[model samples]
Target: MTAVTLTADRRRGLQRRIRWIVTATIAYNVLEAVVAITAGSIASSGALIAFGLDSTIEVLSAAAVAWQFTRRDPERWEKPTLRVIAIAFFALAVYVIATSLLALIGRVEAEHSTLGIIVTAMSVVIMPFLSLAERRTGRELGSATAVADSKQTLICTCLSAAVLAGLLLNSLLGWWWADAVAGLVIAGFAVREGIEAWRGDACATSVGMILEGDDHGI
Candidate 1:
């Protein structure tokens, strides 16, 4: 972070990297939403449905960052773009918490969904890599919006893991409550991230000071 300064040429390269990374993220989440929603509907799994909805929000958040990076002066739009990503995180937190609570109250026992299991498992493997790439690029470029979006992606990875664990528990045993509980936990994570994004749009010494920081080496 300290060593690599974002000169004009380096800035362009990092922006391009962010675009490509977000594009791939968008594509994968679109497919994930379709599969998870379909599988959740068939299996009557509220957690899976919430997961799908979260994917759709991820698409929107990533799309915001993608759009921001396309701006002629991307750094100029950092605050607003990060606000958008933060709102998305808050929205996801609210929705997941509601769904999880309802599922718990109803004691909803969903049918075994091989599709749900497979899709969530796939996300668990795929999402962290994308998140890490975007985060590193964002930090180097001093782009708050891009970094916020990466955290959102990381949250999705956590959600994927929670859902996968819940599905496995339900499938192997009869612990249908597992996914709902996990969703509640992930919702808390989302809220915490949302707060970070909201207050952190203007990172101390990072904004407008590309690649001039400590060598924490993130």
Candidate 2:
């Protein structure tokens, strides 16, 4: 095959892989959100609640990617699709910050959550590799949407780490406030990432797309 043909084939394969990953991530996030919420409520763990909200945001981001991929013309859809995802991220950040603040003011103390800790540990183990693979494929294919989705996965990995640490400290040290503190930290990181995604900084790799052209016509 010619170089152009090879590139085209690679793009197709990457897109297919991304689609599958997005679908699985969405499904997993939905289940994760439900479980996180239930576990958080039972344990009164702020970190778990924040983690659940973050998963919900990931679901929204995945939906946006699915929509973008389905478009007949991805280039034409790119800017507007990214804008939609950004808006969703911004809104989620606002909600998370507001609720976290309210909880802090109310002096809420979190209980021990074995289930939340277990789930968070699992996410920490799983998400980083998946995100790195998606990001590598996205760089090869020059798919901004896929890259943005990968960033979301990266954020989830970070959030899982923070949640696990907070839960562990609170459970073992009797530091009831650590979970709420962790939620604040997670919210800060999420807000920063959300703003970056909303402003298009996260998906600004159009240079690759430009070089490759479209439909293997390079």
Candidate 3:
């Protein structure tokens, strides 16, 4: 892929844009976590609880990227920030796997949660826009951390869909197992993305690596 040469002003602008995107993502996920966790506890829906925890993990990932951008030389912080994001993904996978297993072993029946459904539905609509915007900006800026964080946001969108489906199935057809199924599905995706981020492949986005001066080599 060809590198899109960015002027100094544009680079700074993109960095600022990333900070804004992560901040917005963090804010929305915070509200989502609170509402979903509360609703999940009331409804005894493990999927909803897992969804809330995922939101918290998304917050952590976005925060890492935001912190990376705050540095005077954001590129220097890229690898560590990406690793932080990777660890967050793994943490989410472990939690969801354990929750799904416990829910299955215990034969836990998930009650319907109207709030959980609503919040997840909202996320399904909101997260994609944020992910796309950040991804485009990241690609142009050649920011690995930004791109990885965008992927993290995209994962939230998928999880929102899965959790929403599970809630609907349980509510409409008494498919209590759907909740556990959704949790397991999310865990699988999380582990895959975690491995990619840890291996630094997430930075293989089309930006062709960031450069402050004229040096550019992959």
Measured by lDDT, the strongest candidate is: 1
Q: Write one digit per residue (lDDT tens) for candidate 3, span 1-218.
A: 55447767777788898999999999999999999999999988878888898899999999999999899988888789889999998998898889889988898888878899899999999999999989877877888778888988887898899889888988999887786777788789889998988877886653345534324311
Q: Could you tell me how far off, in angstroms, the CA of residue 20 lies in candidate 3 after the best superposition? A: 0.7
TM-score of 3: 0.92
Please report how far candidate 1 places residue 133 from its true position, in Å: 0.3
**Which residue segments of model 1 deviate by more than 4 Å?**
1-5, 201-205, 212-218
Question: Candidate 2: where are CA atoms >4 Å away?
Answer: 1-6, 207-218
lDDT of each: 0.88, 0.72, 0.85
Q: lDDT, candidate 2, residue 26? A: 89
TM-score, predicted candidate 1 vs. hidden true structure: 0.93
RMSD of each: 2.6, 4.2, 3.9
CA shift of 209, model 3, Å: 3.2
**Cα misplacement distance, residue 69 of candidate 2 (Å):** 1.1
**Higher-ranked by lDDT: 1 or 3:** 1
Point out where model 3 deviates above 4 Å: 205-218
lDDT of 1 by residue, 1-218 (tens): 34445567667788898999999999999999999999999998888898999999999999999999899999888888888989999999999889988989999888899999999999999999999998877877788888889899999999999999999999899898998899989999999889988887534346767665433333
